[model samples]
Target chain A: MADSVDTGRPAPRTSTHSLVVEAIENRILSGELGVGDMLPPERQLAEQLGVSRAAAREAIRVLESHGVLESHVGSGARAGTFITSMPTAALSRFLKLHVSLNNFDLDEVVQTRLILEVESAAMAARRQDPEILQRMGEELAAMDDTDLDREDFGDADTRFHVALARGGGNRLFADMTQAIRESLRAPLLDGYRAHEDWSGLRETLQHQHRELLAAVAAGDAERASQLAAEHIHTSYQVLPADSGGSRRQGNRTAAGGV
Target chain B: MADSVDTGRPAPRTSTHSLVVEAIENRILSGELGVGDMLPPERQLAEQLGVSRAAAREAIRVLESHGVLESHVGSGARAGTFITSMPTAALSRFLKLHVSLNNFDLDEVVQTRLILEVESAAMAARRQDPEILQRMGEELAAMDDTDLDREDFGDADTRFHVALARGGGNRLFADMTQAIRESLRAPLLDGYRAHEDWSGLRETLQHQHRELLAAVAAGDAERASQLAAEHIHTSYQVLPADSGGSRRQGNRTAAGGV
Candidate 1:
């Protein structure tokens, strides 16, 4: 497998580690390698690619960080680097960090979420999956706990949206939805803590959740989509601005309602 | 800054490097560390966090892979790891690998793209930005070239959609659109190459692009959205399947249409 890599002409200025990384990535992209496939050991890979073991090790570390490769210790069948399928957590972490760095504006993030969740809710309603409905119901019940604090309620809220996304029966959409919701977790929690009237807002939010669930249960796709959008818009109206003006200000100026 | 880490009780099995990674991630998420803020030197960070220098270095590598940090070498004001804002290529790379791994089904990816681009088209129409429109026009002209090969046309096609996305005036939405389009580039190119009647399909695609651009130029949000959806649906119909049945087959089985 290593002999297939073209090493006749090394590109000038490119690091040996990067070349190895690109060679491995090309194999994966070409469908030559896949999940659960173990890669050559550092020494073997270094020899095969005509690079140093340190370069091979660095490449492994980079791939491991991307959640594309998993390293196992010990001398056993499984004690090697294997291609892994772990997109959800990795995507969430990537989006969360970029969001924290302010690479994406808060309003744009919220708007993107509105687009995804609204579509997800509609699809979920159309599918009407009982298992997903049950999971969402459980989250709704948890959110209704009288003694639940802001942080706990926020977590349950995230779960509810995640469940709805999964119910749509589209893994890609669900993963993106999950990542966006999780990325906003910290800021949303801050907003919840700063609310002037937590009880009133909580009741309103709970009521909306119940209605949205009912829409899904009844297989009312249009209503579910509309309700999801309105819920998000209303929720954003109350959340405080993280940096500049509140999202409510931007929403009013933006064209096309929800 | 390192003194703020909660290192009172480290999990027995968790690696020290992971703990360091989490500490820095927490500081960023909490807004204590913004973009452009340089992290302490590896030695100092290790000492402050009560971890080995090797662990700190590993943590830095992980963050750098995620596009959250950049390392500058040599001795100068810029010679250190600083938080950076560069999530586009990183995101595209992640999505491409996962798509290649089949973690996300092709139909699901297409569906997600539809949800995003349809809204993007409408938003672009509503915004009607002159510069974005000019960019889209240039891409359209490039695609009109009779001598263009499959590869060049595909690249221009990707650029056209990317321009429409940027015209939507939502950075988050545009970035997601760009990443999704780029991730599907190879498969789409393959499908383009395998077609028995390239010119016929090319004409149809170019005509559809013209109509979509006209809708956007006219500021007809509904028309632009409908055109965008129809264009994607039509284009996907002609593309060959990577595995299993074609996307057209899956679309026929799936409920609801854009």
Candidate 2:
């Protein structure tokens, strides 16, 4: 494994730990498992899969980290390993780390997210599920709050877009959008803080949000999509090109002595 | 933690274990740790973080599963854990599991991917890197192979689009497209195998792939984007709507007896 790591490849997938991981994955992939469903005990899972208890536990940890499974210690319903659906947590974790390492550039992140957001707004207009629309409205109000600061506004802004994604009734789009948006939350906040005219910028953003919501409410797919694209494009264009706009601002200082 | 897990909430995230996780994550996000950078010994990390060794080890496992860290044993450069960047493996693994569990409907998957593939084609046209163009040509040739099976063609088709995505020089888009395409490889193969006019369909697909490559090579971003969108839309529409088209075909069988 170390040799493989040295050579920059993954370890062989046939290890006992990997087999346990695969066994669980096979069940999920086969539709034999799903969210809200409890797994057999760790002992039973190991026994069924012919692996050691330690291997099973580690496999559970891995799956849990993947957001495909969750485990609880006490003996009861919901107190055992169970399938879960938490794409946002896992995807955000993976993407944020990779983004921080400069494996992905800021321009690409902003552009890719813009594409998703545009499609999401279009879909939301066509679908217009009342529940999701309500959430979007609430997030809009939060963003419009007079007391909100830069960070709070950033957070609310992210939620508002995520709500729009959900309004499209596509979990995959919503989840991916959530991950991408959340991963950029800090950097975007830094961009906001660094701006010379945040007050003006915030007003423009709030106005766009309101108009976009109106488009969705009116079931105007094309207008909603156009608004979403322009909203993101303006935000990016207005933000300073330096500061936290790029990941390498702190790159040279990280010796990683820890 | 068990109580929280039982209640269907994440652990508070401030526990000793989570503290270790956060400390490591902070280092990575701060750019203090990055791809190829090694962490301290487990015992040393535990001491510095003022956490138990078990907590630190679990934290490492969690991060490792998140695809942000790799660990190995033996005495050398790669023996201990090192930060790593592997977006495809992590995202594909996560997407495949979620898709199989029907957390994302097939239509949304197809539509979301269409949105991305279209953007990727446009970007690839504008960039036209020699290496990526060569890879696209190679995949196109592989698809043109007369002896290729449905599965082989499916794999080749995925690679061609992924190559186009890479040509755009956006690791974020390319990586996301890779994850989505790879996750659908088996189902798309299933769709291809179930088709009635395999020969005719293959020819049309090969033609589209060649034209797409040509448009990309000619730097026609608009044509490339349009071609990409039509290609995916046609593929999904022409395929039988009943045959492995919906995720629910195998849904009932998955009592997840495991």
| Index of the highest-DockQ prediction | 2
> lDDT per residue, candidate 1, B42-124, as tens digits?
99999999998867877887787787877766677767878776677778888888887777766777788898899999999
RMSD vs true structure, all candidates: 6.7, 5.5
Query: Which residue pairs clash within candidate 1?
Result: none
Residue B97 lDDT, candidate 1, scale 0-100: 82
Q: Give Cα-based local distance difference scores for all models.
A: 0.80, 0.77
lDDT of candidate 1 vs native?
A: 0.80
Against the true two-chain complex, what DockQ does each candidate achieve? Answer: 0.38, 0.47
Give me the displacement of residue A221 in model 2, in angstroms: 2.1
DockQ, 0 to 1 scale, candidate 2:
0.47
True contacts kept of each: 0.57, 0.67
Q: Which stretches of candidate 1 lie over 4 Å from their true place?
A: A1-13, A243-258, B1-13, B50-53, B243-258
Candidate 2, TM-score vs. the true structure? Answer: 0.90
